[model samples]
Target: MPVIKDTFGYLQDDRRVDRITLSHPRSGFSVEILEYGARIRAINFPHARRGPVNTVLSYASLREYELDTAALGAIIGRCANRTVARAHPEFQLSCNDGPNHLHGGLIGFGRSLWRAVACVDGGSPGVLLELQSPDGDEGYRGNVSVQMEVRLDSPLSFRTVVTATTDRATPLNLTLHPYFNLTGDPDVSIDDHELRLAAATYLPVSQDQIPTGEIRAVDGTPLDFRQRTPIGARIHETDGGYDHYCPLLPGSAVAAELSSRRSGIRLSVSTNQRGIQFYSGNSLAGATPRMFRARVGLCLEPHGFPNALNEPTFPSIMVQPGETYRHDTRYLFAMTQD
Candidate 1:
């Protein structure tokens, strides 16, 4: 177990941006992260066939990330997804996503500076990143102290735990937005990637991407990822690719399983959260250096329902003053024998 610190780059005015690399030699697993946005710069997992693969989509330099608008490999906070207008009348959030506020508005946690510290525990090699949001920061109520701990457990496992404490009762949701392409090649499309989600129902969204009140079944629609299906099989059936929130049922708690046949890599996602949002990089154009193109990667975000604050029926994301918001998610990776 080794925790290595390096000067990644400077954000502005000689502001030293630091990065930490945690490696588990025995497992051949490593993760490099930057303090600027508490973003995961790269994830190296040893696949039986591929040797080592960077599972998440990211840029080679900090400059590209500073200019990145796609929210690549970053920690999203305040609220994870789009928040409806007047969702909470007291808040005036930045309307970056049409009339809705997207990913915590303008200065979201995904684009903020976080304090970093090295941690080498008996369990895993990791880093602890912390950030403080002011009372009225990003039009959210209450001052919040947020901490995200990223750990690499073994050969091909990454775990994250996000905790937040607010001074007052407020709606809060946090998620890691990581675009994953198991091919170990960014130039390839994920069209052939097969996926199965442990979901029987999904929340539909409006034209503006705000979640509708209706929770629809996946049995009849193309949203049915209940069975193993190639992503390209029904991608054309949907209007804007896969961008809906699928709520996990009692027996469907594993969340999702994605595999790329060409790479012989399989990813099983497990999380305690009730919902997972699957996005097929439909809106990406030139977001990254080489690996950024439509259908190149997919994001399986495990968290609470989007727009839950507006829809009372959806699981509440309220973090009380005395309570700490906690979320844990793990991605288990393996390579199938050919």
Candidate 2:
């Protein structure tokens, strides 16, 4: 199917926003993307009874999207996750999350407008969104240019390839923040959803949610999803819910798998990143539009270790001059008999 473009709405600054639709005819699977944040507005998957159900949490209008704090289906950049505040003396990173950096500061890349162009890859429909971040824009060094190529690779499957280059040495980690409910019904929670991770160990965090520099095994812990298990089976044992990073075991192409028996929808995530952040939508209780509830959706973000800038033991996220940073991830949706 051809990509359809339409007006989404206008920003408070009077800037016009656009939405792009990429559809696959054979599977009746489609994706809608808003140019405002390069966000995935919706992922309509074919259902036996419902026809096409939006399996991802999204806002009703552009206004609600502008007021979004949950990240929704947006692309996070500059650095995907958290970083310790005041750790880097030379780089005065903006502290948006209570003296700590969260999701690339207050107005991160997810909140910025990106230039979109229609494109096709190997006969697959897609779009290319580009953004330029000047040095010191987010208290980071170097002017970085990023390009995200989103393509519908096959029936019920899509892929994203993000590439960036910096003029000076700077920390760069980018990831997509999409909340999935599988059931496609806002009134439903993902408590019964089955999940599995390709991780044998995970990073333990302190009270501030920063990694404590220890790579611990998931065995004997609720974080263990080495085998498929219910999401809420042991959620109560944690402080709130799962919000830790699990390092992906080497040679594992599939990072995570999620499925909902209620909807018979299954989602598999594959990425080249080293870890995945499993956020069970702990803070979705206060989200806007009144349709949100805690645990109604979950986020599986694949990126580098958080606070890598502060932890010498963690792998570095720095990209030197003339070096191009690249990260690729794929999402496949299918129906399950069970």
TM-score, each model? 0.95, 0.97
Which 10 residues in a row give candidate 1 its minimum summed lDDT? 284-293
List CA RMSD, all candidates: 1.7, 1.2
Q: Can you tell me which runs of candidate 2 are displaced by over 4 Å?
A: 121-123, 289-291
Candidate 1 structure quality by residue, lDDT tens digits, 1-338: 46888898887566888988888767777788889888887878777666779977878777777788888888888888888856676667778778888888887998898988557744478889899998888778899999988888775687888899999888788888888898878778888999999989998888888888899999879899889899999889999688989988876656899998888888899998888899998877756544377878788888899988888888789888999999898978887554
Q: List, residue by residue over 111-229, the lDDT tens digit for candidate 2.
A: 99987865663347899989899999779999999999888999789999999999999999888999999999977888899999999999998898988999999999999999999
Best by lDDT: 2
lDDT values for all models: 0.84, 0.90
Worst 10 residues of 2 by lDDT: 115-124
The whole-model C-alpha lDDT of candidate 1 against the native structure comes to 0.84
